[model samples]
Target: MSSAALPTSALAISAAIRSGSLSATDVTRAALDLVSARDGEIGAFTTVTAERALNEAQAVDRLRAEGSKLGPLAGVPYGVKDLFDIKGLSTLAGSKINRTRPPADADAVLIQRMTAAGAILLGGLNMGEFAYDFTGENAHHGPSRNPLDTKRMSGGSSGGSAAAVAAGFLPLSLGSDTNGSIRVPSAFCGLYGLKPTYGRLPRTGTFPFCDSLDHLGPFARTVGDLALCYDVLQGWDGGDVACVDRPSEQASQELAKGATGLRTAVAGGYFRRGADPSAIAAVDRAAHALGASEEIDIPDVTRARAAAFLITNAEGSALHLDNLRHRAEDFDPDTRDRFLAGAMLPASWYIAAQRFRLQFEAAMRKVFSEFDILLAPSTPFSAPLLGQKTMMLGGSEVPLRPNIGIFTQPISFIGLPVAAVPVRVDGPMPYGVQVIARPWREDLCLRAAAVIEAAGVAHMTPSSL
Candidate 1:
């Protein structure tokens, strides 16, 4: 279990563990040592649960000793975004106000499942307060510095998750995508991140940023690790109303099918409208790998973005109505305005946004009827300055953090599966692109992403101080 033998994928870790060449405790300890050595700069985890992770690692090793079956993720250690509820731990959601909150009563379903599969939970990671922003710059928790470039932003609200994996602290991390949070940071940090079809993973225990758009997923150094986590995490969680009772066979059956003959297109129009050159080039590279055709537009992306904004604001504000009324001062200034702004949105506008989502979903289904996969930039640019609010995108200055959701919103608006691949490109904030598919079509999305990643046409940011 030397750090020299650190795995690049969770599947590889599982193999090592199963063959008695490595133990879960060794993998967990190595991850902790790396975090100890590196996280002061990365600032990925807000709370490092070292003792607990070690205990869990020992438990996993005990499972192996008892001749019990280990899951595909066995012996892997991953950071969890702070927003998810971890048993006996307060679900901070990266907010200062939550300092007084009590520990969780039980583990989130996804956490329990990963643990059952022998994965060790390292700790809760940093994020935008209450998952309100796109940049992983936390005023209270401190910004999650990009591993590739310390001065740049880590894409939020899953910034820490991305940094943790990208910095080699661990090969895998669990993150949530509410308007590209997972994909954006993963792109910036140069890692593989999947925003599975909405509800592909249950949201029952994750803090809600926007109920309509929230998605739970995995971040890793390779597509194979993404699949390993997905297989362990996806299933029917009866408590989560959005969870569809798909057969448990989904991940294993779909992953290696490959993207042969799949009709793919580069998303143009709004998707291409205001993105950085690095972002555009990354998508372009992916297009060539998939043999994608020229630009195809998904109508009304601008309006859809607005609608998504209204809904997110309204829902998020409502969720914290009591807190805003009394403890407003305790909230982070960067996100406080966003929450208060949401509180002022007219109820009627919120209703219209929901109705629009239905129509939007219908329109997307029609588009998918024609194409198998849609390719687009996960973030409009590579990571920006830690507190940056603007960027020159496609010849126009746009709000960087908020506008980062431009390309990702339209696809997630309809509950589609998207596997975001961080292609190697020369930049401070390494760019990444997403391969999106129709709802429940992660098979196609993963296939296209794997192809793009395997081509090695895109450059990956190296981890060096």
Candidate 2:
């Protein structure tokens, strides 16, 4: 295949495969070769299922030869974060302890959905331990280095998902977002990531992390690809308690409707304070591009963030209580300490946080009633150095790990859908803006993102590496 064809978008690849202009096996081989050549420096994948990928690709080819209809993702190559259960592979969830568990009996709900749609899985990607990190530093499986700048953090716990797409290893990948895993990495790696409305996509077969807040979504190089993945992953699954039993919302079909008549606003108040100037500028550029002059403040956002922390701690601790008792030493020290602390939190604190969450969600709903879409900085700044501990936020140095999701936590805390669109900047690394919409209104978020992408204000320029 020509170099130009090698890095084509997922849609393009699918079309080519359908037309017999490209073979799925060849495309899969090229992707595997790229991963083998570049993953040593990037460390995006924890496991690369070469044989499985090739076999799946060959099946697609055979279907075409037999004149059978193909799925939308016909020959696209993709992967999922380690948390997802890939049949026969221990669902690591970025923890060493999980390696000892028996292999998964079947694929995750999303994995099954993707494969049925004809997208071959490359393998399980690396992630933050137990999905409790935002810096993308996995002590056991070294940090998934930033494709743009190896020294910088890739953002986590979906770091590898974002890094793979950004580095052109694959056109799409699946990731989970509890606080801001999907959006943060999208911001840092210059990819288009979707953290769909909480429960929009089923989380069955994925390891738990703050059950109330955890979400599974996709990372892609383009808004359309993101929407396509979202559409495919839609539908109800009785296996996941949180899965909404609603008909699939055809976001990709609706994307062409554009952002017309949408009431757009830039978030002010808590969102404006303590953000990096560059992050602020990116939001400004996006807001300007979308003709959004109105500024709205989300009520009690700080308290919302605190509530998220308390809820996450309590719930995550509860889920891992047994492991904490038996395999505490197997966890990353940071994760172990946080889980231990959470196990000690009073049940009253968790109850209060849940009660407060309802109030916060109500406030946000009112804001959504007035505005169709809201824009905010995805991260406070661009990717930080891998081992860097402190950052100058609002002129005060703060610990980097927790603060990186400062702008994202409050939004996800309320189960709002957000599309993280990378802002084109004149720096070595990239930054992004969040296009947020009310629950189940991912169409609005994606429409606004498509508009920004068309204007050249937001894009995914593949990393040079």
Candidate 3:
């Protein structure tokens, strides 16, 4: 089957499969063929589970023949970041040392949820080493290139997840966001990515980067697809202590509201600073579409970002201390150095950051009381050229890797749900704006994103590749 003949959206694909217009096995094979033919240019998949995928697709077809009821995501093809366990593959987490570990005994909780929803898993994706870096330059596995422009970065550590959907290989993909992994890649790749409220979705069976900050969510070309995947993945899981025991709140039905009666504001002060012209314009466009004329300052966001940094460093370092002690040579030098510094941090710093984090969350809760949505730039700039380091920020040159998450970290620090919507621009590359909402209010974020999307201000652009 030609790529052009396949349905581009998850819902459409699922409907076709259910209606017998497309067989699950044929659709799955076509998607695998596309990955095999073009993924080399983008390096999105670390392992393409063709045999497993075909087997699953055949199962779906068998069920259909038996006249069984199908789930919402029946026959929809997708992939996940390498950190998620996949039953028989080593969960690489984008590290060379992890290659020595035994294959996983079971799939991650989210993967199981997707399978139960009738979604077919295509493979495991490439990502930043141990989810530490933001540039998507994996030292062990080759970097996952931007699908729009292969020469540019795809953004990390969920770079491959973003690239796969943007490249038209999949309609949906799962990724983790400890610090802007989902949003950064979404911004760069021109896709809608949801960084659901922390603890909103279960993280069991996924390799840990920062237990305190890590969040798993989905990437899709459309807001509807993102909402569908998120709703299906929701519910409590005892395996992950961080997973809150909350009832599943579906957002797919909330899209029709479209920012109606919602008090929206544009984030000013810290968020507006250090951004390129295009990045700020993207926020302005989204805000205008959402009727967010009011601008509000989030106090001490700079400090909030610092606290997030400390928490991430300390937690990530502790989890990998054993690996750092022994197989240091197998580690990616950039990731290893960050983990080393994190290990040496005084315990008091982590404690102080945790204290300040509570204060930050409280402050944000108050701000949310006044507004239903806050719009901010997803990235300070579009995708940077691959392997090209350093960029100008705030009238001075700054290291590129750490600064990419400047706008996103503060929001993530407080565990708020955010929908990163790609904003249309005149340039070749694309950037995005974050539609942020209060904790457990992913519906509001998705609603605001739908508003922007309906206005044609935020939508995914096809990749040139």
Q: Write the per-residue lDDT of candidate 3 for residues 184-232, one digit (tens) a residue.
A: 9999999999999999999999999989899999999999999999999
lDDT scores in order: 0.83, 0.91, 0.92
Candidate 2 yields a Cα-based lDDT of 0.91
List runs of model 2 lying over 4 Å from the truth.
1-4
Error (Å) of candidate 3 at residue 454 is: 0.6
Alpha carbon lDDT at 9, candidate 1? 71
TM-score for predicted model 3 compared with the true structure = 0.99
Model 3 backbone overlap count: 0
- How does candidate 2 fare on TM-score? 0.98
Q: Who wins the TM-score comparison?
A: 3
Per residue, candidate 1 scores C-alpha lDDT tens digits across 185-231 of 88778888888888778987777888888899989887777876888
Between the candidate structures 1 and 2, which one is better when assessed by TM-score?
2
Q: C-alpha displacement of 359 in model 3, angstroms?
A: 0.8
Give the true-structure RMSD of model 3.
Answer: 0.9
**Quality of model 1 by C-alpha lDDT:** 0.83
Query: Which pairs clash inside model 2?
Result: none
Task: List model 2 lDDT by residue over 242-283, tens digit each.
Answer: 999988988999888777999999999888887877788899
